[model samples]
Target chain A: MKRIEKVADMAKTSRILAAEGKSIGFVPTMGYLHDGHLALVREAGKENDVVIMSIFVNPAQFGPGEDFESYPRDLERDAALAEKAGVDILFHPSPEEMYPEESDIRILPGRQADVLCGASRPGHFDGVLKVLTKLFHLTRPERAYFGQKDAQQLAIIETFVRNYNFPLEIRRVATVREEDGLAKSSRNVRLTPEERKEAPAIYAALKDGARMLRESGDPELVLGMVRNSLGRIPDAEADYAEILDYPSLRPLSAESGEAIIAAAVRFSGARLIDNILVPLEGKTS
Target chain B: MKRIEKVADMAKTSRILAAEGKSIGFVPTMGYLHDGHLALVREAGKENDVVIMSIFVNPAQFGPGEDFESYPRDLERDAALAEKAGVDILFHPSPEEMYPEESDIRILPGRQADVLCGASRPGHFDGVLKVLTKLFHLTRPERAYFGQKDAQQLAIIETFVRNYNFPLEIRRVATVREEDGLAKSSRNVRLTPEERKEAPAIYAALKDGARMLRESGDPELVLGMVRNSLGRIPDAEADYAEILDYPSLRPLSAESGEAIIAAAVRFSGARLIDNILVPLEGKTS
Candidate 1:
């Protein structure tokens, strides 16, 4: 795979590809690639003549006292994974190259970013939207792949593309997981062995909530049962757990037809978040 | 010349031209086709294989009490003028097409937008930046043209392009004028007959400021004299008459090398603004 660094170089290469009438698919990520990232790449590689991936540990997405400086980065391994996944170009730009000057203009996604992760970490989605827009413009890709693990981000990006009339298709891929049902995340590497054992508890709680909704058909009862069960896991602190509308990420009522069982837990200082989409009466895609 | 009323159709045409290895130049305007706009179109047409002009009186750029609804628009006349100026395509999207939903994403240029026109109308530059970004992405032009009459706007757009890494060149064309020396603008239609007669005072003030700087070589004396002269016009109120550094748009001192005299005035409920760039003793271009 070809590795590019400068934004100018990437734009020039994409210009030539566009001139040749070739379609490009893009997958943007922070380093330390996992199964979820690989799944996005495979989906992008299947639909376009060229597949491009970007690995940027964006500082704007992290808040104060967050993991901005100590975020895990393994370029050698990440590049190998991307190449095996059929990526044609891997863009690895340094912080200086990506943000040469201070940015005064920020892209805010109205009410869409006013809840969920946006509510918890202020200005986080603003950073994501900025970098995503820059990458999208630089690559001019025909399609972009995003995983369901970041469902809120995917929804905000969808609003961005529609509101700005961006000429690209956004494909949402299913969330990938480990054999033990723990959602794959680079942050999972930071968990201690004991915390790792309890990390699966978060996913288990989500599954329990989903299963209860499918069986009892009461979202409130399912949420209360999962909340009570998650509190019993020793050394695990539940940050937030609730039933929300699938893609909208809004709090769902007990009478809602479809909902997502989402939860965030703090285990050994590493925050783990997971969710499962389940229908109250019918199946949710 | 081909005329497209829908953004989607224009984008399709732009995409086809890009695929054919043609360089596209863009000129975005708010219709009514003044000499200044024609000058920009001619300049863009000369340098590009295909030239596209968009006439959108973006509502977001106007304040709640500003003249968004009364903004002058004549698509038929604008199309003829664009065609005469050798424009290849004219993109005229309606309000609904441009903004299907309310966009909360505001592109505010903090310090750069907090002066001059921005001072009088809050949130004005944010709207300009947002719409300009959308237009830039939709056209994907190799070069975009803007009249230097709106000097601060040109400066903000330059910074936006650099900070965002937009792979497009920005060309600043000289301000076009009428025989009476008043700068060409659609807002000129808002001036009463008597107010129209005195409208040239805005340009006169800029020229007077430029001449004083050239003769006395004292930035303070030049700015004071211009402010005094503009204060003399009847029914014309001077908003601000300051000399600032070129490109940066910051207030310049007597020791500064390069400066630009920018001013804004209001007469008969019509706000008028203009600027003139002066190369200092040591500065060139």
Candidate 2:
């Protein structure tokens, strides 16, 4: 796979590929690849002539006192994994290369960012939008692949892409998980021996919460039940447990036929997030 | 020129042209076409295989009491002028078409949007950035054109495009003017007969401010001098007059290599703005 670092070089390569009538599928990620990222890459490869993946641990996305400083990175392992996954180009840009100067423009999001993971991580998705804007313009993909694991992010991006009439398609891939039902994530590697064993409970609580909410029709009770389940994990703090309208990420209502049961839990070293989509009684996607 | 009023149609046309390896040069305007807009269209025609002009009087860019409601628009005349200037396509989308839903995303600008015209019109550049972001994505031109009459806007756009690494070149077309030095603008139509006669003084004051600032080395005194000149017009009110570091839109300092002398004058029904760029003692562009 061809490796690129400079911003202009990536844009140039994409333009040349476009002129040659090659369809590019872009998958942007903060590196330290796992099965989840590879899932996006493989899906992109299946649909397009070329798949381009970006690996940059954006400092802007982490809130203050958050994990920006010690975010795990493994470029060598990531490059190898990306190549094996049929990625035609690996864009590995440093912090300096991606953000040469302080960004003055902010892509502030609205209600879609008010619930679930957004509550604790203020300005996190703003940074995500900023980097994605840069990456989208640089890569100029025909179709961009995003996993349902970052479901809120996927929804916000999909909304903006449609609202702004961005000249590309957003392809959603299902969340990749381990045999134990733990979601595959780069941060999973940061789990200690004991926390690693307990991680499966996070996904289990999400499933149980969705099943419970559909039956009880009481969101707050389901939220408390989900938080109670997550809090049982020793040495782990439950960050947030929420029931929001799916894709819209707003407070749920009866007419809203689709909803998401989402939660975040913080281990000593890593803060992991997970969610499940559940159908309501009335309307469904 | 072919006329397109739909968003998807414009995107499709641009994409088809791009697939044919045709470089598109874009000139985004607010209709009620004048010589200044034509200059941009003419310049676009000279550079690329396709010249696409958009006449969108974007409501997002107007403040609460601004001229958004009364903004001049003449689609029939604009189409005739655009075709004569060699425009291949004219994109004219309605406000509803452009913003079908309320925008939750805001492109908040930084210090670049805090002074001069921005001071009077708060959150103006945020709207400008929002609409331009949409246009830039939908049109996907190789190079976009902006007139230097709106010097602060030109500078802000240049900075953001560079900072964000937008995949297009920004061509700076010099401000087109009347024989009497009045800047050509759609708002000029709102000027009363007497106000029209007095409009030339705006540009004249801008010229004098730059010269006096160079000689006096006092921004405040130079600003007052320009405001005083503008205030002389019968039934006219000087909105703002100042001299500041060019492009950055910050207070001027000795080390700064370039500065701008800018002013606005309100005459009953119309508000006119003008500026002149001056070379300082050091660093040349």
Backbone clashes in each candidate structure, one number apiece?
A: 0, 0
Please identify model 1 stretches exceeding 4 Å from their true place.
A215-217, A253-258, A280-285, B253-257, B282-285
TM-score of 2: 0.98
- Best prediction by lDDT: 2
lDDT of 1 by residue, B104-133 (tens): 766667787777777888988888888888
Error of 2 at B83 (Å): 0.5
Q: Best candidate per DockQ, number?
A: 2
After superposing candidate 2 on the true structure, give the runs of residues whose Cα lies further than 4 Å from its correct spot: none
Worst 10-residue stretch by lDDT in candidate 1 chain A?
Answer: A276-285
| Candidate 1 lDDT over residue span A23-141, tens digit each | 99999999899989999999998899999999999988999988888789999999999999899999998988899888777777777777767788899998998898888878889
**Lowest lDDT 10-residue stretch of candidate 1 chain B:** B249-258
Q: How accurate is candidate 1 locally (lDDT)?
A: 0.85
